[model samples]
Target: MNLAAAHPGFLSPTGVEIVFVLVGVVTLAAAVITVTTRKLVHAALWLVVALGGIAVEYLLLTAEFIAWVQVLIYVGSVVVLLLFGLMLTRAPIGDSPDADSGNRPVALAVALASAATLVTVVVDAFRTYWIDLDASVQGSTAVTGESLFRHWVLPFEALSVLLLAALVGAIVLSRKDGPRAAGPGPVRDPDATGPAAPAAPDQPDTDTGPGSGTDAEGRR
Candidate 1:
């Protein structure tokens, strides 16, 4: 039977699930590009894409609250922090300098294994479960606020403190040093033996020593 069209129960759910899958694919693609791309800014941009894709998936999962929070925190704030880091570090706009390291292959292997394990766990847990919605389960904004203040407030405050600390630390780290202490250099007296004296008329005449520069009066 046509459960979606006849009962109108499956339309939103199916559409949401389809969008979730599409966003998930985009997330994976962005994550791969984020890791493999050589440019630091490009990697940060791909990170935004991955993060935004996750936010979209969260919305599709009927978690509008989480989705918006993700958009505000990760896409807006965290990625901006990443950009700030790049700017302070003076990351070159051209190709990344020695971005890839010897352990890249091992990191990729571990990532793939982790992905496989997560997929297995999710599939094993929810393969047969079906989503059923009657009336929407309304989430109260006040409840969310109160819960955030009550339970997770410390971590949230700590995160703000951490970001502020990072900004201060970046400022400290990126500052160029001032001029060094200049040791006492050689001092000279303007008149002290710069040139030889002129010869007396009756005395033996002597020419100036080697490589002498005449003064304004032309005597050396």
Candidate 2:
């Protein structure tokens, strides 16, 4: 007997499935726009939409913990940091001519090839696999915590380190590349390498004596 025919409820599409499909489509569209948009700020905003859609999908899958984590970590923190970097770097807010280049065809071909490879791999891996609703595997808080700490702890820590490094790098790269402007003090010459030479003291005029003026000009 066919499993799908035996389980009629599983075969039937529900309102949840329809909503999921709609959200997935929106997510895909947002992701495409995020990558293709010429305006950096608009691309960042579109990325928020795409990330939010993924969080919603997680919620639909009954993984509330993961969904909230996604929202907090990716949508909230990461994107905000990205925007902060953009602002600090004084990036252009409007359409940028350099955003798109003449190698668009080559990039598109590479993207399509990567996507096709991913799809083929996934199809081959999960073609006949089905998840059981009653299985012990779950996305509960305790289970997620255990799975993360017990199995994926090192990778998680590494990712945190990576993010920290990226943040530091952004700040470093955005900083002005010269000495800070002098405040209310003497302006030091930036090109001077050694200690400043002592300014020559003013010398009193030896030729302007009391009698020297009379000799040069008797009329005076």
Winning model by TM-score: 2
| Off by more than 4 A, model 2 | 1-16, 133-137, 149-220
Tens-digit lDDT string for candidate 2 (1-220):
3543454354566677778899999999999999899999989999999999999998778787899999999999889978866764457888887988899999999999999999999977754545453456477688899999999999999999998998677545433222353254334455322332222124244224322433333322
Clashes of each: 0, 0
The TM-score between candidate 1 and the true structure equals: 0.61
* Cα lDDT computed for each candidate against the true fold: 0.69, 0.73
lDDT of 2 at 4: 39
In lDDT terms, which candidate is top? 2
Error of 1 at 203 (Å): 59
Candidate 1 residue spans exceeding 4 A from truth: 1-13, 133-135, 138-140, 149-220
The local lDDT score (0 to 100) that residue 90 gets in candidate 2 is 52
